[model samples]
Target chain A: MPKLSYLKALHRALRDEMDRDESVFVLGEDMNFALTNTTSGFLDRFGADRVLEMPLSEQGFTNFATGAALAGRRPVVEFQIPFLLLLVFEQITNQANKFLLMSGGQRSVPVTYLMPAGGHRPGWGAQHSDQPYSLFAHMGVKTVLPATPTDAYGLLTTAIRDDDPVVVIGPLACLGVREDVDHADLVPVPLGKGRIHRAGTDVTLVATGHLVHEAIAVADDLAGDISVEVFDPRTVYPFDWDLLAESVGRTGRLVVADDTNRFSGLGAEVLATAAEELPLRVPPKRVSRPDGAVVGAAPELDAVLQPTREQIADAVRSVLKESGWGA
Target chain B: MSVLDEVPATEADSAVPDSAALYRTIRFIRRFEERAVELVKAGEIRSGIHPCIGQEAVAAGAVATLDADDVVLSSHRGHGHLLAKGCDPARLMAELAGRATGIDRGRGGSFHPSDFSANVFNATGTVGHGAAIAAGIGWAAATAGSPRVVLSFFGDGAVSQGALLEGFNLAALWRLPVVYVCENNGYATTLPAGAAIAGTVVGRGEAFGIPSSSVDGQDAETVYAAVREAVVRARSGGGPSLLEMRTYRYHGHHTFELKTRLRYREQSEVDSWLGRDPLLIQAARVAEDERARVDAEVEARLDEVVRFAVASPYPDPATATDHLHADGLRPRPGSAR
Candidate 1:
């Protein structure tokens, strides 16, 4: 078994895909030096044509990738975040995403938007931090946020292969995650599937992105005292609702830990869906940022704004308390 | 080997359609637009379309330079573009009528439609965005060593859009084989081009280091000649070129204007443009009898087109969410799975 880091998994998946498919090419800003390290050695291996270094014009390049995809090529665009994905929000959401439906299925825009620096950056100002995966999902653009190294590699591979516009958000929080795995087992993970890290009889805890690892830790910390099931919906858009239904069915208690804002965020969607469909014994609790939150520059303020493990644990306990179940 | 030597400019003109063929296209576009407008009046096309009545030459001329393999990205006022690019008139009419037999499954009624079958890749509803989209297609073709030139058609209004200029930059930088034809219809919806765009239309391209020029958009041959040279340059690996065609739309910006009577453009200005009508200019080249024959043929075909469009079935409401994904992934409904 070999240890693979999350960043490496992303890099490996990109290199492998480009190697496998001649039509697949990388387009984005600052790829010559691989400033993001996602396409570290791509310029040499893939050549300038395949690993293109686009100008700083994000909107122009985003739509350009759409055109490339429309012309029968799969363009994996690297959007340097802080606001790269946000800048081309229309290009992806309005233009690229709608190409297939608007074309009446005559064409497909398989342009994968990879945001390596998505989610909150510690002590960074609002400018350098924002998670727009929910935005893409809301716009019906296929969005994925892999929580670990293996999931990162597998999900990214699948995203490239998908014949629709997909936004792969590699959140900074989960970038440091590493796991020991057999190389052969690193395979494509299907979109709209969930990986339940730990199963518990008491409550189903749904988490996404970096919050998944945080959720698993809290579930472990509360092991003997409380039973908690940590479920990671790898592909956020075509969510693994069936799996969530099964988990919540057994526990009858639910808690969601999402890194985005509480108002109209991923957490809100999960809570809403659970309320509508799930057979819940207790009122579900969700750990998420306040309405329209921006992680402040100060480290402490940033830490406080984030959904910590304590909040997840407290949310689980609160749901149990509401049901009159022993904590 | 130089790609220029391989595909010379002189050799490109050998494929340019004869004068009779050009007149037929202009006449066909004029008739198609008039018929489409009638369908709009009949309420077959729920949302009234942006009628490209007066500006037929721009589409006819620019598209004629393109080979069957070349692709085009069109704007909102793009029925003429689709027709000139060889889209089946029946299917296009069906598309406008919101029928299942339409080119886009009736999903793209008027604003956004892409007929890959006709090499018309897309018609973006968002103004000016088609420029960058076309640039992308050109980049892909050049990268693959394919000699396919991409033609992007936009209104003078698009010249002011930052995204459009950004598209110009990429096309110029990569020298990606693309022909950017700006149909300067002198108005962006209602606002005069003079008021909407600062500097000039061709200047926008020149600022981007693109080989930019202006042509008489009303004359099919002039439009053809200018775009033909640019197309040859593109096929020979010469970067993108921007040709601002001086043209106009006779009807209101859209059918909505028909009832509203926006009164934006002066009647005198309208009368002036109507004087140099593209149909008359192209018809002059062909004999009167031949022109009359084309006119009759066009009317007969349009009659069948309208009939076929009316006969075609509208898509089932249940499949409204279909084609959202190319793989046909049925999204779980908003309610629940």
Candidate 2:
């Protein structure tokens, strides 16, 4: 078994997909130098034609990808900052996303919007720091947030292969997470499925992106006192509700850890669904950022605003206490 | 290629007929807007339209030279462009009235009327996004080796958008068949071009090495001639062309402007633009009897269109998400299951 890092997985997926499909090409600003490292051997492996370096025009290049996708090419666009996705949000949602439906199913836009370093990158502050996966999910765009290296590789491959527009948010915090797997098993993981990293019966902790790893750690820390089921939903939009239902059915208590803001965030959606339909023995708890909190430049101000490991543990403990189900 | 290598510019072909066509387009657009306005007031149309009253020639001339197979990607202010592309006037009226038999099954009211079968893609409510989609359609057509082209129509405000420029670059780079037509109708809502834009629209296209030009958008013939050449260039593998047709919006930027009363432009400027009315110019080109015949036919067609649209049933609420996905996969309802 070989160990693969998250960034390497993305690079491998791009290289492999380009080689597999001639129509698959990589484009974005500073891609030639592999600025994001997601297209790291791309320029050399596939040549500059396939690995295009665009100017600092995020909106322009975003549509350029749409144009390329329309030409029967699968374009994988890498954005260095999470906020860049916001700048080109209209291009993706209005143009690429609606092309198929507006054309009455006459066309398909298979463009991959890969935010390699999504979410708050410490002192990166207001403009650059953002985790906007929920925005895409709300717009009915297929959105994925892979937690680990294998999942990153798998999801990116699946996104490229999908016939619709997909947004893959690779959290800056999770990019270094490595996993050991057989090279042959580096296969495409189907979207809308959940991977139960740690199965438990006391509480179901649904985590997304880098929060999955954090949940895994919290579950381990509370291993002796509580049995926690940490589930990683690879694709957030076409969420694996069936899997969540089954997990929560056995546990009867749920807690969600998400990276977005508290109001109308992914965590809120999960909590709402749990309360509405799920048979929860206790009120579910969610660990997320404060309402409409734009992360500031100061490290301490940022640290207070973002969801922390302690907060995840507290949310888990609260859910467990509400159910009175700790082992 | 030299400017001479292309179609030679002449007063007969370049200025007069061009101006005449511009007037015709403007006239058609003006009359269409007036008729639509009357319908809105009469409650025949539910959602108020963003009239293209002042920017008629842009639609008339640009679409005048397009083949029936050529595609058009329009904007929110797209009714004139759609009409100019030979869309059924009645069905268009029916569409504004939210009729089932309308172009978009009445799902896309006024702002998003689409006739894909006729290659008229609807105006995406998102500003400046159509260019990329147009580029995509062009790329598809070019790769298929089809002699067809795509005309992406947008306003001056859209030119500031990066996506439109991206569309320009891709079309120019791959020589994908497309014509980027910008109808500089003075203002994007209340935001004037002078206040928002940093450089000229034509200069942006020229930077991409796309053959860029400026035309009198108020004249239909000018629009038609420029578009015709661009269409020829695209069909002949000469790639994309960017034409900035300078014009003014005769009416409010949108119907909402009626309430805001944003007086960004002078009344004199509006009066001056009205002097070059597109419909009157085009009507002058034809005999009195011919003009009357066309008018009577258009009026009659609009009547039936209104009737059909009004009588059509609203889509069943149960199937509201019917066309959301082509696979017809209803998103799994939120449940533990």
Total clashing pairs for each candidate: 0, 11
Best by lDDT: 1
lDDT tens digits, residues B1-337, model 1?
Answer: 1101112234336545457777887888888888888899999998789999999888887877778789988999999889877788899999999999999999888888778977999998878998889889998888788989999999888888899989999999989898999999888888898888778888898988899998999998889889999999999998999999999999998999989999888899999999999988988889999888878878878889999999999999999899888777877776655
Which candidate achieves the best DockQ against the true structure?
Answer: 1
Judge candidate 1 at residue A226 and give its lDDT.
88
Looking at candidate 2 chain A, the ten consecutive residues that score lowest on lDDT are A318-327
The C-alpha stretches of model 1 lying farther than 4 A from their native spots are: A324-327, B1-12, B15-17, B335-337
* Over 4 Å off, model 2: A44-49, A70-72, A98-108, A122-126, A293-306, A323-327, B1-34, B88-90, B131-148, B159-178, B190-212, B233-240, B248-251, B255-272, B287-293, B329-337
lDDT for each residue of candidate 2 in A135-240, tens digit (9 for 90 to 100): 8888888899999988888999999998888999999999888889788988999988989999999999999889998999999999999999999988998888
Question: In model 2 chain B, where is the ten-residue run with the lowest total lDDT?
Answer: B1-10
lDDT of 1 by residue, A1-327 (tens): 889999999999999999999999998888899998999989889899899898889999999999999888999999877577888898999989888888888888999999987888888868778888888888888999999999999999999999999999999988888999798989999999999999999999999999999889989999998899999999999899999999999999999999888899988999899889999888888998888887679888787888888989899888877844333
- Chain A TM-score for each candidate, in the given order? 0.97, 0.97
- The residue pairs in collision within model 1 are none
Q: Judged by DockQ cut-offs, is candidate 1 incorrect, acceptable, medium or high? A: high
